[model samples]
Target: MQRRDFAAALTAALAAPAVLGATPAHADERSGGGLSRRMRAALAAELDDQDTARTVVPYLQDIGFDWHPETIAPERLDFIVAYGFGNRPPAGGGDPAKVLPEPGPVNEELADTVARIRRRRTVPVYAQWEIARFLESKYRMKNVTSIEPVIAPDGTITYLSTDGVAAQVAEARKHVPGGIGTAGVVGFRDHVKRCVQTTRDRGMTAYAPRGFEMPGTYDPESGQAWTRRRDLYVVHDMAAQWQVLRQKLIAQAYPNG
Candidate 1:
């Protein structure tokens, strides 16, 4: 074909829409909301310190429990509300510790604390696991999960729980066309081990969920890896145990949509 005719045909073909056979028609998706369009395309995924109050003194209320996010101190957060779920009760630090043996007394203390706080007016709270999930789903990192005590600024007592799942993309860099590198499982271990040691180093108490094993950090000490249940850690948390009733008790469990 003549050069002009060939060029015209090529241009027409290039402009065609991609249905059965069409090319791209618009600008590529951009990264947003903690996700690169590519990373988000892959799977879809996609914060603290304090130690002022410890000996969280308690008073006794009759039924439910409550505690100020901080003792004799204010907090940046009002309650551990999820950024996305404006109305739903964000998981983590809502009520007292539930898994304790003979929880009645513990529950009593929590109830009493709430009552005392009520006498004051209101209380603030720190949120937990849901935040983690938000991060994971946002980032799309398949190999990371975090479940930690959502301690109030007081630093001593943890009223709510938080959990998050990590997106574990295997060898994502080597696999993802272009990325940092193949630092997936190996890097994951290095971090987890470091985290476990750090958690112990800071003297954070063992808050692993009941029956579920306290996930060991990647122990170079034993020169071994942890058991494979990254999913359990990623997707679950301590607060999964207590039903909403515990939070509501006599009061309604504050319906969540």
Candidate 2:
């Protein structure tokens, strides 16, 4: 799909509440099934892998978690996820059946962290602009005074960077003299954090991994958004992963029903 077309779809998707940090679109519902005991056990094993632990450890730190870094293992993290569609195209030919409805299960610990830092339940309407545009508008709005400010010699303000991530800040400052916000602001981490948290809180259980910068094509006739998805960074083997979880639920009848 053309970049412009995808952008248009993204704009429309963002018109509603955003599920991903970049934009929000309505996701199809997950099947009315729960994870089975054995499937849960397998999922637990996958989540416990060293890579998963490594990925989540930094996330814990980002969210102000106070656990011992070494002791922060994936086994302890909760995988009870909220579901959503990836809004991207799959590898090989894009398959509509393969397109996910929401993000995959996140560690419950992460969800709890988001709840603590949350200022409000929802975010702003214009929160999904491209990073540059967002930062440009933010600097113009002067809402970033609290964080360290970068001003040009001509007194044109450019961008703000938190004390953390000094390298990014310095690189951004390089362009300050040109009156262009040389650096993207450091606040979007919070936006992404909140986006994941909000997605989880909304009861989404699965997610398709797509780059936040990558745009997908939306076919109006088919009513599906298609992205040229490269890899399953979010959940390796999403179909298999979900199938395992789904089979687990399918094997056991509901306790009451």
Candidate 3:
């Protein structure tokens, strides 16, 4: 799809009542099955739209996928929270040390951004899982705390999620004066929205930088290699968004659960 056409579609989609984030009143009418089916049908339609693939490329670029860092006023932030990316252990067992994941490209980028921001003005940074360790050991960042994942006795990570991280941050904020004030949510460009939303759900006002500045003149949607990479990133982002919606529907259906 042409860039202009993609923008139009996106604008229309945003204005639509059935946009991804809106919750229907009857979401739990069928024990969540009603909303689930509706979302599945919407996703099916999105998949069938030929322009979706082409449009997503530009959408990601517009959303700062190429890493145009935002102007962050550190003084406004009470604290910063960095989310983990691809830092989970493998499902199939292997050497524990080898299976332990290090920060991926996204996390590394987040670390670098957070580290730079810290240099300007120091603030407490709470990172999930290995990111906390990475910041402390590699960047030597002080006052960095790790939000550990819940692990079952069988060695499986039971509750390593964005919501889990935000919950921990919310609890910790109780000690901070003014509590849950403005917070910086650091993560990949595409993942930042969900991070900000989850953080807000936990009662913290959150904002994410545009992301690490795209080094030099590299355009993520221009070249063939970059285009393919952006497509994959968009696909993964869409799936992640779907998961968030699914979880929201489940919660609405079973608030006690």
Q: Is 1 or 2 the stronger prediction by lDDT?
A: 2
Counted clashes in each candidate structure = 31, 26, 1
User: Which digits, one per residue and each the tens of the lDDT, describe model 1 over residues 128-190?
Assistant: 233334334443323322334344565543432112211111112223333322110111221
| C-alpha RMSD of each candidate structure in angstroms | 25.7, 20.4, 11.6
Off by over 4 Å in 1: 1-32, 36-39, 44-101, 104-109, 122-234, 237-257
- Output the worst ten-in-a-row residue range by lDDT, candidate 2: 65-74
TM-score per candidate? 0.16, 0.19, 0.58
Cα lDDT, all candidates:
0.24, 0.27, 0.60
Q: What lDDT tens digits, residue by residue, belong to model 2 across residues 137-156? A: 43342222112224557555
After aligning candidate 1 to the native by TM-score, how far in Å is the CA of 34 from where it should be? 2.4
User: Model 3, 145-225: lDDT tens per residue?
Assistant: 888877667676554678889999999988887656778877655556667777887887887643344112212432223
Assess the local accuracy of residue 174 in candidate 2 as a C-alpha lDDT between 0 and 100: 40
lDDT of 3 at 84: 69
- For model 3, which pairs clash? 67-212
Predict model 1's lDDT versus the native: 0.24
